[model samples]
Every structure is written in structure tokens, then in C-alpha cells.
Target: MDAAVNTPVVVDSNDDGTVTQELELEKMGSTLEEAIVETCSMPLENRPRLPRITLSKRNRAVVKALSRMLIIFLEASRDLCETDLILFGTAMAVCRIIGAKFSTAGRTTAQSSAIPAWGIIIEERIATKMDGGGR
Candidate 1:
């Protein structure tokens, strides 16, 4: 899904005496979108500044894919710490993406390269969403 499928169930008491569980898709999407915005926009003192040659053409698409994946993972998760684990786990993927996007002819080792592309990944991720393409 292009948008996040998470927001979980909301328990609300009606003006009457009935209680209900509401699956508010819009609310969930907006809330998750906000969370994503907050997470991505937080400033890092040591954030890397990738050169123009190192940027990905698919920055927006890749970030959309990754965010959707994260939402799916978050929605399916049971334990809270799993969320933490899943979030932290993307570090490897980000490095791999950086390596692949800016590959040198034959001298690049993403595993050992010190490119510091911690994002453009994150920047591109949130940047595109808030730009013209995102909902």
C-alpha cells in the first residue's frame, strides 16, 4: 500500500451508552504520516551531506517503498521492542542503498565504505513525501 495501514483500533464512547471500536483509515494514515514526518525531520548534529552525484534517481520511490514496508511491519508487530528493532535494522539497508546508488566502477565496499549516507535516505524519504508527489 502506498499509504500506511496502521492506526489500530480506537475505542470511543458514543453520546449514547454504547462503546465502539473504530478503524479510522484516514485518521490512521494522517497519524502515521505525522509520526513519519517527525522521525525523519529531526535534526542530526552529524548529518551527512551527500554530493549531487551520489543521489538516487529513485529517492522518492525507494523511500515510499521503505516507509510502506515499515508501516506494514509496525502494524503486524506485537511487542513494542520489535518496532525498535525493525527501525534500527534499516541501517544496513540504507548503507546498501547508498553503495548501490553511487557505485564506483569496482572500488566500492558498502560494508566498509565510510560514505555516511545515513541519508539522503532519510532526507529523501521525508522530503519527497512533503513535496509535490505525496498525498
Candidate 2:
């Protein structure tokens, strides 16, 4: 996926003659929701199968509520920094890319396989963040 094409860029000019470019990930949330819905609606045989994971309705409701709360928090924060926006954009992009890869793999392969690349990438990111004290 081309970030330039898929992501929306917002340019902010400060009074100090500095410019900041922020990528808005909220816009991609709706598209990701649509993709999730479409993936869920696929025929049983066409969809990827995970053996042990299950999200209960209550858990899902909680997740949805928390997601809404997070969005609201992001909106209400006047001190929102570029790093926050960048992290959100990166997270959304990773999710979408992983989802696309899984969907493609489901269509091309007979059996579901572990996403080692994405898993390793996420682990490394987490480790880096931890090492940097959540910089």
C-alpha cells in the first residue's frame, strides 16, 4: 500500500515559521471497519480460520466503547503532538497491511499460516518503545 495515496496529509504552519505534517488515521478507521465487515461476511470456506480465539459480545462491546473513548480523547486534547498522530497512523497502517496480507493469503493458500513478519515487526516496535521509555 502506498502511504502517499492512501493516507491524508495535513500541513500545519506554526507562528515560528515551522511546518508540521500530520497523517490523519481517523479517516482510515471507517475504511478499516468496512474491510473488517466485508471479511466477516465472506463465505465460511473463503474466510481464514483461527482455532482458539473468540471475542464475546460483551468483550466486543467493551472494545467498541473504549475505541470511542480513545477517539474522543484524541479529539479533545489540545496538546496533541505530532508523535501521537504519527503513532496512530503507523498503528492503523500496520493493521490494514496485516489484514490485507491475511486476506490475500486466504485466497492464495489452502491453509491459514502465522503472520511472523508482522508479529516480529510489532514486537520489535514494542521493544524499541519500551527501551526509549515510550518516546
RMSD per candidate (Å) reads: 19.7, 18.6
Residue range 1-135, candidate 2, lDDT tens digits: 433222433323432322132223344444444433454455535643322223543323323433543554355446645334433433333344223222333333433344567887888899999899668
Task: Give the TM-scores of the predictions, in the order they appear.
Answer: 0.29, 0.27
How does each model score on lDDT? 0.42, 0.41
Model 1, span 1-135: residue lDDT tens: 223322233323442322133334344334444544433443332223322323333333333344654677578667865565445334323333333332214334365364458855776779989896767
RMSD of 2: 18.6
Summed over model 1, clashes come to 0
In model 1, residue pairs whose N, Cα or C atoms come closer than 3 Å (at least 3 residues apart or on different chains), thus clashing, are: none
